[model samples]
Target: RSDPSSFCIISRLKIIKTDISLDGTKKVLFELEDGNRIESVLIPEKNHFTACISSQVGCAMGCKFCLTARQGFIRNLKSSEIINQVIQIRELLDQPEKLTNIVFMGMGEPLANFEAVKKAVNNIISPDALNFSRRRVTLSTCGLVPEIERLGKDLPINLAVSLNAGDDKTRNMLMPINKKYPLKKLIDTLKNFPLHKGRRITFEYILIRDINDRLSDATNLARLLKNIRAKINLIPFNRYDGSPFEEPDEKRILAFQDELIRKNYTVTIRKSKGADISAACGQLITGP
Candidate 1:
């Protein structure tokens, strides 16, 4: 009765569907006001949880292995939409405060929607908001060079590059953006990024069988990233229907990681999670 119209009410996105995987991964699909949909995944760790959020409804970069790219460009998500993903996921957990990590690896290239993505990051780390640690928040991009440089200048958060291919020709085939920035230029930009002490940029390399999984590819990748303080996350390709690539055998994937370790590079093979529900890396495609 006390001036109800005076109070502001922000509209929340509608949750279209929720699915829990056998591995305990939870995916929530939210419908935007304009009818476009974006999905976020809540991944539980040993004691904490990580929220993988999206920055765009669909992707424009056209990474050959990504399902979101197949949806093409719908539009950039609003900062509110991006921030709401974390909030909604946090609300789903038993110990909400333990959701300690956030990754911008769900649907689109975060750096492509630079301004909104930056605003969302600020809100996520702000004391009045989610109150997340800057170190615990990682933003992934597909090497949008200028935007990447700007992000480094504006924020101290962790950065991850979706570097699926080691060389230009192969990279150009897998990710079209490589043709614009190229490997050398992108590496140079990252090398010059202002990273804090004890922190290394993360490079995500997805290994496709007979494509970018050869030992020579690992050697070239090791050489390319030697100058930069970086750790490698090797993802054995997660395949979907109509997808041309195949995930490498476990032995081949480990051999690739060992080659990097022998070269004195820190590497980890990312275990594919939620494959049954298509909620793993490069698999967040929203259905009509």
Candidate 2:
């Protein structure tokens, strides 16, 4: 017979609710034992689905455009708490096996919670555990230079930097982390990242209208990323309640991308999924 006491020890976090976007993306809210809440997103692509997991209950990075930053920092999630987001979403999926990718792009900067994130990532790709392939997992950071170096030394997984702005002035205004790491240091670190053959790092840029979508911005971004094997993902800003920024016009978005292409850089416009339910990029704040 099983011990009742063992069963009494419950998970630190529990699913509170899940909201589905018209586009079919799922945003699940999880409440911690102490009542703090965090969110995770599941986005479906053409061939497979990707689980966007969180590493912190809230974020301290304080990016002006990110909803999570407004919540302020709560605490780093334990490895189990982080992994549970993935496991729970997998269980919720009608076709769990279709989950082929994982991105640490949800609530917190994964590198900030290094040890716990590392542990969770190991189990995620471990043959004895989830057994996901190395290429299928990605960690996105808001340009934490030292931590980025440490991650390159240790885990060396696929990396994506949230390079939302092309210059220091705009970047500093948008992402406060830029004040510390800055663009030069962050780019230098990315240039040194140990990428496998033909694998490129991803640079995510959120195009906020009248903010960082100008052709000059694209030119500067191309120059900044020159010689670095990277593909830029242009995400038009997803507006939420009381947000100060507006989405760039579709024509401008394509123009910005075309400028980068002219500069010989590979770029793509990322479709903003789950925007209706407030689950798109930079919009993962806890809600009612």
Candidate 3:
């Protein structure tokens, strides 16, 4: 019921849909009652119970490599829209149990719509309802520091920070939110997070060719993550329209990942999946 707040109700009710199968995981996209849309992913491993949910219609955090920003900010989804993404996908895909994992990594900056995101996650983990564990859910953000720290105190779910750059100058260019919060402030907030050192903090670094893939950047990133209990997921750049950025060649990417491992850092190179269907890393949809 949470439609784009600022838009007039004169907007037509149109629905656009898409489905993706990645690494044998099946997902269906749903355009809801509101002008916004959301997606649900059914991973075979989790009995197709995994659903990656979105908290907002369009993203306000305009990451340079993202396609969702083109549609701009619509509105924050209500608790129903967020929960329905799971229900609709199950009915369409015939895998209701497959809606297991709920990730706030889809269309918008989740923390920007924190209350809705919190309500949705609560429904997901509620004993009388969808009934998922906090460990099975993850929330992704573009380094919203104060919000990040707030989540540590409130939510028990896994957290992923879209850490595209190790330094401020590089990050500011890749993600404009950097100009406001900056890397140092982000790190300080992470360090002060209620989660202990042993618990993993996922740093999602999308490797753009010649941008964040160099050996020096990798080393510098490892240095920063050293103090925090971090697991870095190096995501290959997923291209979108107007983004001149290119995914780094595989060999170079492997080398850069190796450099981090050599530095005694826990790192993993996430294979680029669903790019062929335009549902990869930064290719999330905004609306109908």
Best by TM-score: 1
Looking at model 1, the pairs that clash are: none
Model 1: per-residue Cα lDDT over 1-288, one tens digit each:
122123332667789989999999999999989988999999989889999999998899999999999899889999988987887788787678888999999998898898999998997888666779999999999999999899999987999999987899999999999999999999999999999999999999999999999999999999999889999999989889989889999899989999999999989988878887899998989854
Question: How well is each residue in 26-135 modelled by candidate 3, as lDDT tens digits?
Answer: 54566666444665555445244556667787888888888887778888887677766655555554545545677777888999988888887886777656677778
Q: Residue 218's C-alpha lDDT in candidate 3?
A: 93
Q: Write the per-residue lDDT of candidate 2 for residues 1-288, one digit (tens) a residue.
A: 122123322464688889998989999999987788899999989888999999998899999998999898889998888877877788777778888899999999899999999998987787667777879999999998988888888885799999998899999999989999889999988899989988999999999999999999998999999989999999999888888999999999999999999998889999789999989999998743
- Clashes per prediction? 0, 0, 7
RMSD of 1: 3.5
- Runs with alpha carbons beyond 4 Å of true place in candidate 2: 1-12
- Model 3 residue runs over 4 Å out of place are 1-16, 22-27, 43-49, 92-95, 196-198
State every prediction's TM-score relative to the real structure.
0.96, 0.95, 0.88
Ranking by lDDT: 1, 2, 3
What is candidate 2's TM-score against the reference? Answer: 0.95
Candidates ranked by TM-score, best first? 1, 2, 3
**For each candidate, what is the lDDT?**
0.89, 0.88, 0.76
Q: Pick the candidate with the highest lDDT.
A: 1
For model 3, name the residue pairs that clash. 48-98, 49-97, 49-98, 49-99, 49-100, 50-98, 50-100
